[model samples]
Target: MSLEVPRPIDPSLHPLVTGNYRLATPAIEALYELVTRCLRYRIPGALIYGPPRIGKTRAIEYVRLLLARQHPRMSSYHAQCEHKPRHAEGPFFANLLEAVGDHAPHAGTSAAKRSRLLLRIREAAARSGSGTVLLFCDESQRYNENEYEWLRDVHDALDRQQIKLFTFLVGQQELLAQKTALQVAGKTQIVARLMVEELAFYGIRNAEDVATCLNGYDQTAYPEGSHWSFTRFYIPQAFDAGYRLVADSGTLWQAFEAAHHKASLPGSLEIPMIRIVKDVSDKSPF
Candidate 1:
């Protein structure tokens, strides 16, 4: 990820993105691979995670497209986490029921929906073909205990169905550690069969509140004061309302980076300027 406005990286550019161009953006590609494997009965499942707007949703959308094109016989659905607190139980069952093709009309009672839900779940599994189902849950960090437990149960129910549903969970960095804790608490059996992939923050450094996209690390977050200098040096100033903002005007942010720890250098106050956003690419998240 980069902050420099000139070097923008647009995530919606295409249907297929090879990591060879992204340099350090391998996390999404790796998560995409794991989901592909899960569809083919290779892995039990995998999760996709990162800071918000860091490309988690983009990865899932790409994978879903690939799977639909190549497989053509699987079911796919996406569920967003609740913004407010909720018992995971109802939503979990309802989602699973929908996934299996139950599509139950809204009901006031879970018990009333149970029979048809199980029927659909069983029927989807009994398709007697190379059929699979995938559920991609975004913003999963909001999942409370109820949601977490419901997730565990869903894993179990899917296993019993033999539907080979691949679940890709997308969430914050805490989701990783939280999953481990939940599994250890004996709330889940899918833990043994599940694997957590790592997506290190190769981007998002050398900045505060995110000036550029996920370019490099911020100058602050650690000792490299050169980061403050680097961002100031590389990122051009913003011009607005007849006011020309220069790199020197970045003094406060530079100091912020320095406090995080980077010592920048002084540059010419009257350096030649260039307008070059189009010339730059694959740097900042636009």
Candidate 2:
């Protein structure tokens, strides 16, 4: 049998077919509100936990961009916790220092490194002409009791220095379990500080939520002064030329429903955002 060549993608439809798009789902809106409240009230720290592959990371990224635009002078730092054999405090503080553009020392005790990190954070805040520092820690479920205590120490230090530091701990559902375990183990202070509010991210529940997601892409503007509506690109000949169309067409809704059914959990009737997008992308070629 002869090998078949793949057809080249049309230039006009490139943007819509590729790249991740941000939709203002209810979870994302809740995240925005959480951040807004934290910044407005100068809250010390908060935790955001959700299931895996449900757009938690994407929501964090969107929040980062939103904060950068809204508070240009605020300093933002992000650290991804790793599951390694080494002590968690070392890598955690090192990553924090690196995120703020400071070099972590190669030869120092953990306490020394942490002290240096505190100093660096102060310097970064001064350089940025603002005392507000936002720290986003992803994969926080890997942290143990000691790691939680370390974070509390950092938060306390920032508070004593009069710096407004807000830490957002983003992780999977186990994050709550871990916090509960800490509380049960008599680590109430850590639980009190980090568990101010746990924002849980649930997937799309109804057709209106799906419509909101599709409408986001539909309203998005392309470089050619046109919208990226699915009805315009996918219908009327999947590969043929057409004008922009509204999202009211039942075609896109049916695709979303099918994808949701396929991706929903056995007992949990929830559909992850990633699965829906993947289903849409897979069907775009038709």
Off by over 4 Å in 2: 1-21, 86-88, 104-107, 222-265, 282-286
lDDT of 2 by residue, 1-286 (tens): 1113232345344555665455567788898899889888766778899888888888888778878888899988878777867666777677666766776443377777799889988998898899888888888888877888888898899889988778888999998888788778888898777767678877776666777666665665444365434444454343135333324435655655676578773664566777656656665644
Reference-based lDDT, residue 238, model 1: 27
Top lDDT hit: 2
lDDT of every model, 2 decimals = 0.49, 0.72
Q: In model 2, what is the error at residue 145, expressed in angstroms?
A: 1.0
Error of 1 at 100 (Å): 6.7
RMSD of each: 12.8, 5.4
Once fitted onto the true fold, the runs of candidate 1 whose alpha carbons sit more than 4 angstroms away are 1-26, 95-105, 112-128, 188-190, 193-286
Query: Where does the lowest 10-residue lDDT sum fall in candidate 1?
Result: 270-279
